[model samples]
Target: MNRSLSIIMPALNMEHLVGEAIATTTRALQRAGLSDYEIIVLVNTSRDGSHDRTDEVVLDLAKKDSHIRPIINHHFKPFGLTYWQGVDLAQKENVMFIPSDDETIEDSMVGIFKDIGQVDLVVPYTVNKKARSFKRRFVSRAFVILCNTLFGLRLRYYNGTCVVPTKLIRKVPMRSGSFAYMVQVLVLLIKSGARYVEVPMGIKPTSATASFKIKSVIEAIHALARLFWDIHIKGVRIKIPF
Candidate 1:
C-alpha cells in the first residue's frame, strides 16, 4: 500500500502561526518516516492585515521546501470550502487537512501519519478533553450525539482532522461549506461502506472557540439540515468499492 499523503493546512487570519504550523506538520511527517508527501498550505482571505503576510510566509517556505505547496485565496470563504478546495488540489493517495491555528500537537499528527497505509480512513479523537473549556466540551458532545442519533451510527468524534483516501473523498459530494462539512462527508462515506479506524490524539489548549460564533453556528445548522435532506429525502450517497 502507498503511504504517500497530501497534508492540507488551512489558515484564516493566522499569519502569526501558519509558518510554525507548516514547520510542525513537516516535522511530524518526517518523524513518522513519511517523506513521500505534500503540504498544501491554504491562506484564505482574512479581515485583518494577515492575509498577504500569511501568503508571503507560505511562499517563502515553499521556496526552501519542495513539499510545501501554497494556495492563496483572494476572496473569503468558509473553512469547509477552503478545505474542500485544497482536497481537490491534492495529488497524493491520501489526504487530510490540519488547521493552521496551531491547535494540533506535533505528536498527535505523527500518530495519524504513522497509520497512513493501515486503514482507509484514520479518524482521530481528542484524548485530552480537559484542554477545551466546559462550554466547548458541552457543545462538542452535543454535536457528536446529534450526528450519531440522526445518522444512526456511532462515532466518537467527527470534526477532528481525519486521514482519508483522496479518491474516496473525491467521490463524495461536498454539500456544506461550513464546519459541518466534515460531518456530512463522514456520514456519506461511512454509509457507502468505507473502512475506518479510530485513534487517540492530543489537542493543544486554546482560548479561542470560533465555532460558537453566530455566523458559524448558523452555518452549522444549515449544513446539518441540508445534509439530512440530501441523505434522507434526496437519497444522496457515495457508491461503494470505489
Candidate 2:
C-alpha cells in the first residue's frame, strides 16, 4: 500500500534538537519509501532563555524542505492541545506525533512507517527500557498497569508514538489536555475495536525527562482522572465511523 503520513512534531524549548528531529524524520520517511508525507513542526511557546529559537529552527528547516511545515504558537499549550492543533491541520492518510527532543531514533521511525497500512493503528513499545532511568521506568510501568486495570485491556505501552488513521483519531473526542492524551487516545481507539498491531522499537537515551517532572505528573494525573470520570462515570464511548 502506498502510505502518506502527516508527522506532527511538537517542539517546546527544543531549539538544539528540533532540527535533528526533522532531519531524522525526513530521512526515515524517505527510507521507508514514503514519497508522500509532510512534517508539521508545531513550536509551542518557550520559557527558556533562548529567544524563540525553537520556532526559528523549524522555520529555517522548513525553508530547506517543502515537506516541513512550521507552526509557531505564541502562547504555551499543553502536550495534548499542541498535538491536536497539528492534527486539525493535518492532511494525510495517517498521522502521528514525533517529539522535537530527538529521543526517538531514525530507524525506530522507519519501523513505524513499515507497518503503516497493516492496521488502523501501529502501536510501538520501547524494546530498550534501559535507556530510561529506574524512576521513569517504574512510573511508566505503574501508569500502564493503572490504565489496563481501569480500561480492562492488556497493552505493553500507552505513551509511545502510535500511528493512526487521520479520520479515526480526529473522530475520537479528545478528553485529556496533558501528557496522558496519548493514553486516552489509545484506550478509546482500542475499546472502539480499531485494528492495531504492537511493534517493539528502540529509543535513544536522552537526559530530558520532562514528563516525569512533578508538575507534569500532577497534570497528567488530573487529566487521567477526568478521562476516568467521562468513561466510567458519564459512560462516554467513541463512535468511530468507518
TM-score of each: 0.93, 0.92
RMSD of each: 1.8, 2.0
The local lDDT score (0 to 100) that residue 101 gets in candidate 1 is 75
lDDT of 1 at 171: 85
TM-score, structure 1 vs. true: 0.93
Query: Could you give candidate 1's per-residue lDDT for residues 1-242 as a string of tens digits?
Result: 86999988887777788888888888998899999999898888865534558888888889999998998888787788888888889999999988887889999999999999887789999999999999989999999999998888889999998998888888877557777988988988887788889999898898787457888889888888888888888988877563
The lDDT leader among the candidates is: 1
Alpha carbon lDDT at 87, candidate 2: 82
Task: Give lDDT tens digits, candidate 2, residues 1-242.
Answer: 53789999988878898888888888898899898999998888755433458887788888889999999888767788888888899999899988888888789889899999888899999999989988889988998999889888889998898998888888767646677888888887887778789998788999976456788778888877877787778877777655
Please state the error at residue 83 of candidate 2 in Å.
0.7
Task: Report the lDDT of model 2 for residue 34.
Answer: 91
